[model samples]
Target: MATAHTHVTKQQAPPHRAAELSAFGVLILLAGAFLPIMDFFITNVALPSIDTSLHASAASLQLVIAGYGVAYAALLVLGGRLGDSYGRRRLFLIALVGFVLASLACGLAPGVGVLIAARIVQGATAALLVPQVLATFHHALEGERKARALGLYGATSGIAAVVGQLVGGLLVGADIAGTSWRPIFLVNVPIGLVVLLVAARIVPGTRSEHPVGVDVPGTVLFAATLVTLLVPLTEGHSLGWPWWTWVLLALAVILGAVTYGVEKRAERRGEVPLLPPSLLRLPSMSRGLVMVLAFSIGFGAFMFVFALTVQDGLHADALHGGLAILPMALLFFAGSVVAPRLLSRFGRAAMSAGAVLQLAGLAWLVAVLLADWPHVYLWAMAAPMALAGAGQSVLFAGLFRSVLADVPAHLGGIGSGALITLQQSGLALGVATLGTVYIGLAPHGASHAFAAVEYVHMGIVALLAVGVAALPRFTRATPVTPVTES
Candidate 1:
């Protein structure tokens, strides 16, 4: 018996050590994830300053936001494929360097055109950087460690948007030697440099065992499809709904069909497509992706509209606008930290509960706004915002887990890419669609516009709650031990 126990211990020791990702290493990976998302929202609060400093038109400002989002969404799958074929750590380091360079260009840009171009490049590099974080988590950790790491990732994502607004407000308000909006982009420099340096020493290298080459035709079609779809949605209203915008929207649908057909044919021919059709066939992946899209749309709309309402409607400064959302950010982090425990106990029902909580919070917020109208204090909205934040964090963590749970390890990069692409696209769409509505109605009354948007948010969350009921119950299973590379 003693000899058997000793033999088993010897066999288990190496795998145990191999599975360990140091706390610092995990932090570095999470930072990489945080920067890209934060950059997206940071610019929201800085737009006014940018307009003043650069003398940019409303259309140009919209382009600045759209360019980054379109590039990021279009290239994400390619980034994932590159990481799988090349090396995740190598790609991550390279992308981080590129992101920092692009940030510098944005900060130093003398004209609106240059800023737009730089933002696009920044978004492209971000595509390369973000997927690697999720791939690493999938490849390097498992069991309880994996669950906790994912929870932290969810927390990081949820908080980064609010932090972006807060940090952007602070930096812009500071005027940092009269630099105005420039510091928002420049802020990424030192942080990226430090993370890049530490990541080189700590992050384990990983890649697919049977890596495939890039699918050229599929890449072009996919890029074109997303450009047609996203460009119009993001820029249409700002540009006064031109004929070209409608044309592009129509083209997007046709191109989307072609892309799907092309991908299906490639799969049938035993060729690797940019997006593997087989991956979407998994019930969990498909259902979870739909949930992610719905949830993200509401989240995106809320952030954008709330910022505008507080600043433009309430006539609050950028600093005060950011402060108003601080409670939500704090509660979101708290909920995310405890998500793993919640999941272990309540399973899929936890997601349902979260959605209900979010709906309740939204309803409360709407009621408060209706009562106070133009005089509503920011603090009056804090409790509901905190409740909504906690609920969102819980649902976000659950959806992330469900989406990736059944994805084969070899396809982790693509899966992560797909998940994030939908998320980013949904966010952009939210800003475009509901943002247009709010802008149109604002001329009548800010309070009415705000309440209408919140009502839409409530409807979205209600749909999510209903969708959660359809998800299959979670079944406890033994965790797979992943093999990590150095």
Candidate 2:
């Protein structure tokens, strides 16, 4: 249920906009929230340049991306829980400040070592800032206003996925002020500084009266599990399949098992486990999370593979490659905008439809690849790309609501964090497994190699469609998780 009118007036609603504050305050809050997601995609296009300029290896480059994602997924829950315990506004400001400092450190990094360190620290601070976005909106808005806020937030994510490419390509290709790839990191400075100042004035502070204490042990254990699991997945290929890679992978599994035991013990003792056991108990929530992991892995690997196929295999320049993805980008925005409406009507059926469409598109795409491996062009690929893009956008909105629908307010942060962690682990795995397979299969020409890679991905995407179809039938737009007193 939406909050009482009295609570909304007291807690979050600003009197007016211009005439009063209105929901514009919440809008400003979302702008600050969007930066980190944008940063993730933006960095991918810039990675080749970063590698060449800084003498970073393929392994180190993967680390730059993986390290941020690992830290982000691991600590995101803690960041959200802190907002619940302390205050959302206070943490937002502090996290914003940390993000700025970290951005500056990344921009100024002289060597590969410094850049990687800054990226990890930057990811950590982003964990703190982003959780506050959804929590703040939840605390502050109600009814139609709340739905609009969340829909818009998800839309921003959709837009960022596209904009990251445009911005990364333009800036990196500009070689602006002769900064080369450095401009990509440097550009965040102005944007971050401005958002910080504006947010201080507009966003409201809100926290639940009753909140769980931070689970310190759970945080450490979870972080360790993610780092151990993700590090080798991202770096192992470069190390020539070392024995340590297998060792670390096994250890990550063990650490994750131990972490669950610790959380179970804490729950038994009537303490807030790092992740509340009840979270996993919700069958829909469980399925939604698995969907998040599967979806993100396939999504992450698809983008990475496409970039290599276009640029390295086809000999397209950065600008040309970025422009080629524009059709998908445009339809993605369109799909996200229309999805909230579909959710209100068709419900989880919308998700099923999205999956079927994506599978059709991927299957069509595979046919084109196998038949015209040496002669494919952007024009030939546009149809499947656009359909897949729209289908994917719809899929994410459905997934987001499904994951959080039954989440208790106290543990919303953890639930969201856990979803992201599973998402990232899946993403890292996709890149490692799918990427390794594609690279291994394409032992000859760049064109044939790229063709083989897409064929594999089409099959993977088809598998993901089956999983999405399996999502609990009730997850139409949003399945209501029964609020429990536990």
Candidate 3:
């Protein structure tokens, strides 16, 4: 009996287990992932409440959301580089802990100004937390096993977005034993503690042997270029067109060109760079990043607009808003779980289909909202919402793995960072552009604007499908590196 018990304990260890992850390892990491993704979306549903409680203006509110996303996007590459340089496991643990503390700061913030500041820090910590998940999965699981791990990760991410929106609604609506809207952020504490315990016990330590150091100059340039572009776009709605905004945007373009040239020079000189020149040269990575930029723009804006349409325009309240979004969230998760199987077989065809399905959903939405308007209910909207969710599941899963497939191991951190940065920044821009169009049309009133938003959605979705169809189909279906034994 003693011998059997000892063997059982040994079997449970990450390295001692299969080259594949055990259910426990995946579950623990999933829990760790939960808070970061949840925080991103949940805040959207809670935004109206926060605005009311803190007396924030529309610009302040936009900053509250933009602050987190921009900071997260800005730091992600460097954060990924830090993990690769020191150790992924070490950075992961540090980030998870920081996220918890930051969550506390966010929940306790007394005013709109303080809350926005706290949110920016929280987003930076989240960037540190998220990249490690991808790196760990890359280092820990093998072949189909690695694919499965990524699939689960993508599924969890999609689910979290939905969960954030829904749970945020529930918490704010319930007042949660009189805790009011604060519990949405405060809820991260206990979960973080449990995740820390599990991760310390289970997540394996991994790092690149010849890890490329952070490209300090490149990182600065990249961050500066993106920030100059994003800050104006995010504020464009409120600020209108300003000469300074255009000037900053032109500077961003010039800086982006300069960043690329510097990275190429560094690569030729045998120096480690933030985004290695060699990695950028990969046709797959280059094309993949472009698609990420465009896909994110549409998807990001839709979610923001959807929230406003349901709550502000329709006068539905938090609980109703959550319920309205539930179907999309559920269907998206279902699609993500199955997307790898489809991609493994069909490649770009699978992606195209996903976009088509999503477009169909948008078409349905355009028709329904135009016809139903103020009378639309949770049930009536479920079909289109579910289809949209399904579409996102496919898009997120395919892109997540596909983007990383061609990355050289040495440049993994910056490469991963660049991909995610494109994703984050692009999504922010999408919300800015699509959101601008949606709100620009809002003057025609909610129902008409809702119809117009779908036009933006359809155009974006079609454009993404065209982008995916242009890629090397199954070129990204396989693993870039063998998943290491935990």
List runs of model 2 lying over 4 Å from the truth. 1-21, 366-376, 405-414, 438-443, 448-456, 475-486
Candidate 1 residue-wise lDDT, 1-486, digit = tens: 233123222332222123356778999999988999898888877776787889986557666766787788777777776876788889999999999999999999999999999999999999888878866776677777786676567678778987888888788778889888899999999999999999998888877654556778888988898788777876776778899999999999999999989987876766657766777777767887888888877787788778777777887777777787888888888887886678768978888898888888888888888789789899999999889888888787777767767766545445666777778877876777776677678778877888888888889899888887666566442121121211
lDDT of 2 by residue, 367-428 (tens): 67667766778677789878888888887778877777766553444566666667756666
Off by over 4 Å in 1: 1-21, 140-147, 405-413, 475-486
What TM-score, over all chains together, does every model reach? 0.89, 0.88, 0.89
CA error at residue 76 for candidate 1, angstroms: 1.9
**Candidate 3 lDDT by residue in tens digits, 1-486:** 233123222323333222445668877877887788778778777777787788886667777767788888888877776776777778889998899898898888898888888888888898887877777777677677676776666677668878888898888888777655688899898889889988888888776544545678887888788778877776766778678888888998999999999877776666656666676668768888888887777777778788878888878788788888989988887786688788888887788889889999988877888788778776888999999889878877677667766665534445666776777887667666666676677767887876776787788789887788656657435442221111
In angstroms, the error of model 2 at 231 is 1.5
The window of 10 residues in a row where model 3 has the poorest summed lDDT is 1-10
